[model samples]
Target chain A: MKRPFQNLVYLYILAGLSLTIFLVHCGLKALTVTVPAQAQVDERVTFVMHSGAEPRIEEPGTYTTQLLAGIMVPKSWNAREQAVLTYTSPKGNGTLRMIPDSEIEPVSGVSWHQAAKNMFGIGPNLVDDFEWIIYRSTQSYTFSNNEDIDFNVQVACNVGSENMLVRLGFYVGSSIENLRPEDDQYKKFTFSDVFEVSGGEGDVQDFVNPQLGTIQPVRSLDNDIITLVFNGGVMNTVLDGLNEVYLRAQAFDSDGQLIAEVMEQNDKTKMGSIGGRQFRIDIWPRGFFAIEKGKQIARLEYFFTNADGTKTVGYGNTEEPFRYTFRCE
Target chain B: MKIKQLLLFAFVAFGYLFHASCEDEMANVVTDEPVKNITGSWKVVQLTRNGEDLSQRLNLTDFRIDFKEDGSYILANELPFVLVGSGAYTLNDPQYPFSVLMTADGESEQIAVKLQYPVVNGKRQLSLSFSLGCAGNTYQYNFEREN
Candidate 1:
């Protein structure tokens, strides 16, 4: 009788151990995106995304879902047309297409493009005009119960016409699950090392490092409103630790003649602090300068100054003012 | 004779009620709402691009749009706008306008602009949203009645 009772207890212990193994670890276990440290403009750069995930069957049933990937690049790249994505896993292998701006993310309730933007905005980059081009798998995989899967994706995109250093970003998020799954563990993201694209257009735009001044809509007419950002914390400077800062700028006409200038550190020219050491000001050239009807503004030469105008910061942290050209293609 | 008189009375009452209802239907109009009043100079109180606010960075205080009582508008210190200088303007459904149609001084074609009129902080506000150079970049300008 003792032998039989001992056997029954042993059987119960074995069953518990099997259930524990079946449960396993659930969700995105690990992920990494690999890309070359440097590439030339208009050159095709390959980015390899290797990811592992284990699905936990909360209930007894089969489910169908597709994977999705979001890749961030400069808006000038026209990535929607230039980038191509392909994936291979135990589930299947197929090419991915740019999920139209209309395709909605199941969990986020927003377009995949927008969802990616909301998830990571530039990812520590200083430049403002960046786009997250989202791609969706062409095939769906079926799964039931505890299962382990691995995916390897190949992404190729041509660099845009710009000489710059920027960190690329990648995000793998919420699959097209036909059933319930953990929302948090399904998302993983990473930013690559400073990517250098040389022999491109214009001057070298540094996004990895902070700067004294930056402007948006790199190309715009005088008729459009423009934003100028003064980064005081870029490095040691006169206005580095000051709590208050102001902008003193001169607007020039097409012929390089100074048309209007505002050097007052009053309420109108005071810069609004955007947390940290960054400040911003928006100016409509037509209104700010009050230019005549037929004349057009050529550019703006400006500098940052502290209250009472004792300390000033200019181009290359020198006494020379920073110059920004106003043009539109 | 009494029975005949009672039948005549019933018929007369029914005819009188029917005629009264017809008259009511013909005179049922009671228009109450007046045309939306937007005759004032406005300036850009807020500006946005692709839904990102840039009010602090752009100097929009001098930009002005004057909507005169003569159904004409004049633009001063203009930004990217559909019609420039002065133009003849008209409202769609004057009583409850959802848009304003403007024909520039030289052009005959009409450009319809979506208008949002709201009163906040006890002051009337005019909001206009448009895409000037690229359809991808949208600019919204909100203007409050300039004191």
Candidate 2:
């Protein structure tokens, strides 16, 4: 009878051992098998220029493999945790978002602050209201090799009144300063990060003429007249024909697609003509032409020659080239 | 005999539970669901200057617009030129109409819209306009709802 009891105990011990092994294997398999749930990333790329002394430019930076592609955050992550990365380009600055183990989708039409919180952080004040647009990548690329990629991101934000008036200046340590025509340092820099914007034309003339000082558009058509009217008081030297002037036009479709380009010259000989030769102008399609109907036009950039013979460019008001569609028969 | 069997079953169940809980602790990364409102390809159908149709072509994508509902908006082009603008905006109620009041590139100028017509399914046909320097223009636009 005692021997039978011992046999029973032995059988129980064996069964328990086998069960432990089986369960351990199952747990290990579960841990090894990674199943990424349904995930989506919406990437919006904005080319931004820093105003003030720094005149900083921001562009999209490199990403790590550990950083997931989409902007969605997992439900398990704390609202404060964020994977924030910043990249600086010659033209501007770029910010990339990394969300760890999250399942929450980013909110639409909200400010950048709200979006950043949802993507990787539960923490407040992590996002700057000055920056908007959350962007994502489509084709997956391996970050293992540290490859630099320029992901084409797009989205339309209001071209506020401030930027509406074309800013005429140069970048100084990643910041923009109100350019003075006579300033020698101002003549060295050029325009960059040309993008399409959706906003009311701010101060088209607010952009100072590189040749003449304090410029404004006089009786102009963004679609028809590409004029850069310079006031007499700003810098009378260009009007006196003492200096040469050059105008460069870069055009893009409404969706921010580059369309046509023209660079024309209006030197000292041509300066004294228009009282001020206000339209240090550049014309496309020769004589006169209208945009083909049903076609969408975007950006228009202008660059001018400074007194020292160097150049300074200004961008025109960016608008949708889509023709008016409201006509009652 | 019955007690013994019960004990054996209990032991097995406890082992399974312990293992399963441990698995949850690993770096289980997963993909998130697609966003609802701002997803998919969006075509630029309207361009306005102070509310007037400047009559130009401006076709671009959400990628082109530099708009990600999650962050600030930046619009820039290829080279030799770039401008940075930023501001806040929200989709106003009468949710069906889908109105948005936005300040562009940090400018004080305000833009407001009220959809009037339909462009695509789940999208609203709207009239949008902006104000600056006592001079403002209005235009009609077609915006689709995100699928």
Candidate 3:
């Protein structure tokens, strides 16, 4: 009779254990799992946790230790104990969801601070609001050589703004490099507000370089003109060591039509200040002839007479002619 | 004792749920191809200015340029004056829209010009524009491939 009773007891215990296991598994699975809540614009969310009970909110990854604030559980909590959390958002009341961090795509049209915090889980420490605005408003281009010697030119401009900055970066094959203004002789490589317009016609800005000669952009009112001033000062410098020079300008319209031609003549009397290096020539798209705003000025062709005047110094006649496109506002 | 065992089971189940929700981040990369060589002869087919056609102004016949592989070029102008000039040319960028630096023979000065190589009517052509620093003039040249 006692052996039968013991067998019955053992059976009862086994049944109880199985029931407990099933209940525990079901209870854990039933633990509230919610979808990620989307906060409305300018909304604030508050999280509340019960005392002495902590919830472990691990980052959504196999090996990420990044713990977000307010949701992370403390080690002091009981091993088997789960914390009770209540979260309230000004936008709406919703259950917090457990989704992988990677699934959180940044929403557009939000403040930079909010975007940074939501996407990176860090504050806006790398770039501030002002800096971010400037970055968004600017356009930049970088040019470099692939050779062993490092030479680079970086230009940045805020479009529609009045200024542009150009920087030259040079590095030898070795490691050390420094950008020193003193080492820059020609100053041609550096320019500030190079594209700024003085607003009216006849306003001129001169670019001086010992190696490159003087170039001036002079604005004229008649045809919305911007004349490239290349006079004896520039010619003498360009043809310093040579004798006899032939100079010609070929002007074209926006339709690629040749409209005007100016050739340097041998008759010094007709040429303004014959033997004087000073010369003024109009670029394309002037006043009434100007292309609509934002359209590039007509292209210009330059031909220089060789020292012998027997031939012209430029891209060969059969080869492509050299061209320039300048635009005025 | 029974409660302890249930807690252990619950913990294990919760751990599994957390691990199943993760995914690996994906990466995407893009690349660009470099430009081709522009070493060849080009003939001037049209010359224009300010919405006007001035092809008759300069003799377009026998007007051609020969660019050698060595960066040396010869311009043959067969008009008013039959002149042939030779010079060194340097291309700043090895790309479609690039600047050309031409130095006349025996002259150190370089005249910089921008050019674009485009295909027109199934023929390779070079389109260029420049100003002679004149008061109100610009020139456009369209050159077709000769060789």
> Which is the leading candidate under DockQ?
1
What stretches of model 2 exceed 4 Å from their correct place? A1-329, B1-41, B49-63, B66-87, B94-98, B103-117, B120-127, B131-147
Per-candidate TM-score against the hidden true structure: 0.73, 0.22, 0.26
Can you write out model 3's per-residue Cα lDDT over A170-200, one digit (the tens) per residue? Answer: 1111001111233221111111222222233
**Which run of 10 residues does model 1 chain A get worst, by summed lDDT?**
A174-183
lDDT of each: 0.79, 0.33, 0.38
- Selected candidate, larger DockQ, 2 vs 3: 2
Decide which is better by lDDT, 1 or 2: 1
Q: Is the docking of candidate 3 incorrect, acceptable, medium or high quality?
A: incorrect
lDDT of 1 by residue, A1-92 (tens): 47878999999987786555444545665678888889898888888888966777545755566777788888778888879999888877
Off by over 4 Å in 1: A1-26, A104-110, A175-182, A217-219, A240-244, A252-260, A263-267, A306-311, A327-329, B1-46, B54-86, B90-100, B106-127, B132-136, B142-147
Q: Write the per-residue lDDT of candidate 3 for residues B68-138, one digit (tens) a residue.
A: 89999888854211112889887777654466778878877887766777788998777766654342345
* RMSD, one per candidate, in order: 12.7, 24.4, 27.8
> Local error of candidate 2 at B62, Å?
9.7
> What's the distance in Å from true for residue B84, model 1?
5.0
Instruction: For candidate 2, give the lDDT of residue A5.
Output: 94
- Candidate 1 residue-wise lDDT, B1-147, digit = tens: 677688899899989998999799869867578889888888889988877887766557778999999999999854667777898898887999988888989888999888989887887889888866445567888899875
